[model samples]
Structure formats: C-alpha cells, structure tokens
Target: MEKYLEIIKNSYSSYWNYLKNSVFMELNWENYFYGLIIISLIVWGLEAIFPWRKNQSLFRKDFWLDTFYMFFNFFLLNLIVLIALSNSASELFNDVLGIVGLSIKNFQLLEINKLPFFTRIFIFFIVVDFVQWWTHRLLHRVEFLWNFHKVHHSVKQMGFAAHLRYHWMEPVVYNSLKYIPLAIIGGFSAKDIAFVHFFNITIGHLNHANINWDYGGLKYIFNNPKMHIWHHSRELPKERKYGVNFGITLSIWDYIFKTNYIPHSGRDIELGFEGDENFPKGFIQQEMYPLGRKD
Candidate 1:
C-alpha cells in the first residue's frame, strides 16, 4: 500500500512537471515584450490622437521611474523567484509561508475534477485578489507597511509600467503570504502560479495606463483602465477610491465591499496624489522614501 501511494504521488508529480514545462516553454520572452509594447502603443496612441491630458506628456520623470520598475521586476525579481524555488522543500515552504494554494486544496473537498480549466483559473485569481484586497488595505491603514506600498501610489501618471513601480519588498511579503496557503492546500500547480503572476502583471500595467480603453460591460467582470484610473485620481473623495478596484482580475470583491466606483456621464478625473506633495522623482528615492519615513 505504501509503495502504491508512492507510485501515485510520483505520477502526479510527473504530470505536473510536464504541464509546467509545456506552459513555460510556450511563453516567448520576445512575444511577451511585444504584447507589452502593443499595450503601451495603444496608450500612447490614445493620448496623442484623442489627447485627454493636453498639457501632460509621457516624457515626464514618473514615466522613466515606472519603466525602471518594469525592467527590474520582470528580469531581476523573477530571477529571485527562480532562485527561491530552487531551495529544498520549496513547494511545501511556499504553501506554509502564504495562502497561495488554499483555495485549490479546499476545492478538492468538492468534486473539483468536474470543474473546467477556465473555472479553476477564475477561482484562483479571485481567491488571490480577495487575499490581496485586504492585504493592500491593511498596508495603507497600518503605519509600517504603508511605507513600502507608498511607492506604488507615488506615480502621478498612468502607464503600462506603473504597476511595476511597487517596492520589491511588497511582493516578497505578499507572494510569500500567498504561497503559504497555496502550498498547504497543494491547490496550485507551478504553471498556475506563473499564470497568476503573468495575468496580474498584465492587468496591473493596463490599469496604470492613461489610455481610455474600456472593456465595456466586461468592465464589471474585470477592473479596466478607466476604473483603475479613478482609483489613482488625486481628487478629494475620489482619491479615497483606493480600496475599490482591489481585485487583480475581477471587480466582484469591490462590489461586495461597497467600494465599487464607476463614473457615469464620463466625468474628467485627475490622476495622482494631492496630499503628499513631496513625492520624489528618482527610482532610488522612491524605494528609500518609505524606509526613510518609517521612523
């Protein structure tokens, strides 16, 4: 019986490994960059062609700061993830460290095999977003962590790279917290983890973009650029729209929390922080600003 169980576990491991390799290999670095370029081009095209912020241009200091974040996060931060995974009991550790796989494990309690792949993906993203919503809220409310997250809010302009402007430590803590639950439940495959990262990063970039693209009614299903821009707006009461579009993929949680804010009649919104006027322009300054202010 012990040998049989071992065989089953090995088979499962092999199947998962095959899936990971297949998925990861199919993701071309160039193609991913191309997609980002396309997203950026759209934002730029809208601004140039339709031109919302007449005085605002993409060449501002914030734009480059965001770009730096994008480069480091995609290349350096990802390298760190790979290194972390190389450690012994990496999967188990990831599970215990955060809630990454909790939903998947719990799903097993039901007839999860009957569910479709897209459904599973939906559930995973939703669960992570729910975790993130509260986590993000806490960071802002709590004094210490707020220093780390403030870097994200420092951006005055929206763009594909704004998502990457977040401090590295923020993800270390968030991803670690998430991985614990994921590992415990054995709910997530390696591929699932990668997909979540990719999908969230992509959406995050879109949300930060200044473009006027809206997914229409589908905006209810997912937080689009327009809705997210409102969150970043500097206007009074509008700036407090912070907690509404917390979901990385879906806006369901925002609706549940009564924090949903979607403007009708197309009211013009200002983007960026009004209260904190001392926001720095340099990359190093932004990262260190939180720590400097911590004490």
Candidate 2:
C-alpha cells in the first residue's frame, strides 16, 4: 500500500508541473490549451456561417454546458484521473507482468520505432481509432456502459462542443481498452505525432457540428456531421437496435463492418435517447449520474 501511495504521490507531482506548464508557459504551437479554443472557434464559426439547420438557435440548448464539458473532459477531469488512477494502473499492470518476467515493452510485436515517423503515426491513428470503434460498440451494447454514454446522448442539440459532452468514464474505458492493442505495435507514444491528436479533435468537432457535409468521396475515410448525426438518433434502426455508426475519428470501420446507416439527409433529425429529458443537466449531477443517483 505504501508503494501504491508513493506512486500516486509521484503522479500528482508530475501532473502538477505538467498542468502548470499547460496553464501558464506552454502556449507553444503544440499546446492543446490554445488548440482546443482555436479548433472550437473554427468549427463554431463554420456552423454559424453555414448551419444545416437554419432554424436552430446559435446559442443552442446546453451549448454552454457542452462547452464546459469540453474543457472539463480535456483538462480538469484529466488532472484528477492522471494523478489518482492511471499511474497506479500502469504500475500495477507492470507488476503483474513482472510476475511472468515480462514487461509492456516485451509485447512490441511490430517494433514500430524502426518505421518512418509518419508511418508510425499513421499506423497508430488507424489502430487506436479501431480500438475506440470497438469500445464505442461496447458502450452501446453493454447496459452498464450505456449508462455512462447516456450523458453524451443527452445532447438534444448537436454542436461542435457536443463532440465532447460525454461522461468522463468514456475516456477511461476508451484509453484502458486501447492500451493492449497499442502496446502490440510498440505502444508508440501519441506525442510522436501531436498533429494526430489535433486531427482527431478537429474531426470530432466536425462530426458533431451542425453541418451537412459528408466529404463526398472521403466520407468513408473520415467521420463527418452528416454521417454521424445518425449515430445520435433517438430511435434505432429496425435492424440495429444496438446502435450504429460507432466510428470515432474515422467512418471506415462502420462501412467495413456494415454498421453504417443514413437513410436520408438527417438535417433535422431528433437527437438523444429515450428519457434523455430526465438526464441531469448540471455537470455535477451528470458526473454522478452513472452511479444510479438522480439526486
């Protein structure tokens, strides 16, 4: 237990410095602090200029709430998770491997570092996106996971910020499940391609934005608003009660797996699940929502 406590302590200290840098002196080109704001503004601008739903309000319902969610999910909640959870998880997992005289580094089936820099990032993007695709399916098919995901589906009005208006637990599940698959390919640190993170953020915003572009030919390669709104439809397709369009950053998985569906333009389709009107609107209440406590 002392060792675990020590690990948490170190995690806190390390995260503190990183957070301080991100908050203060880390305004460099790669800084997500500024990137988040910039990317959000760009998408919001596009939506305002050419909104698919011309009748919808610019200040849509829960717009500020979803904005808070974007920052919270990206920064505030991340701090707590890194300090108190992920560090211990990494250490414990390594210890378990130690039992068998192995380490995470031992599972490098592809030796990814030897590959070209762009090649590594490209592979990481595809593999990680695929893992997230499967994890998304789990969120819908598994009742327990769906409860957490409901926070996201609670968005009645889709906007750029709606991309991140998910229960914090979603990231925990996404990251945890992606760990092993990434490790198999030498676990290339995501930092190797800072642009990959930015790219996903851009796509995520666009996917949930109030836009109608399906990227024409590239629609299958990348997720877009037209292809993704069907994902948030309140009613499920007759043949797909488990949900559909489980893509995160790319739509290829959905097309390949036969999970893609768009019967029409869906320019003004209803969003949210049944009973989402009862979903908590306050951030605190929503965070506690998956715990089965309405109050």
TM-score of each: 0.71, 0.94
Candidate 2: tens digits of C-alpha lDDT, residues 1-295: 8999998888778776776887786647557787889899999999999899998887899999999999988888877784468778877888999999999888878988888889989998898899899999999988889999999999998899999998988989987887777767864664765778998999999999987588999998898999899999998867898898989999999999999998988887889898888888899999999997453
**lDDT scores of the candidates, listed in order:** 0.62, 0.87
Best by TM-score: 2
Candidate 2: C-alpha lDDT: 0.87
RMSD of 2: 1.9
Which residue pairs in model 2 clash with each other? none
| Residue-level lDDT for 253 in candidate 1 | 72
**lDDT string, candidate 1, 53-166, tens digits:** 456676654777677787676555545442343333354443554666453344434443356767766667776887787777777667788777777877766666787778
Ten contiguous residues with the weakest lDDT in model 1: 80-89
Candidate 2: 10-residue stretch with minimal lDDT: 186-195
Error of 1 at 63 (Å): 1.6
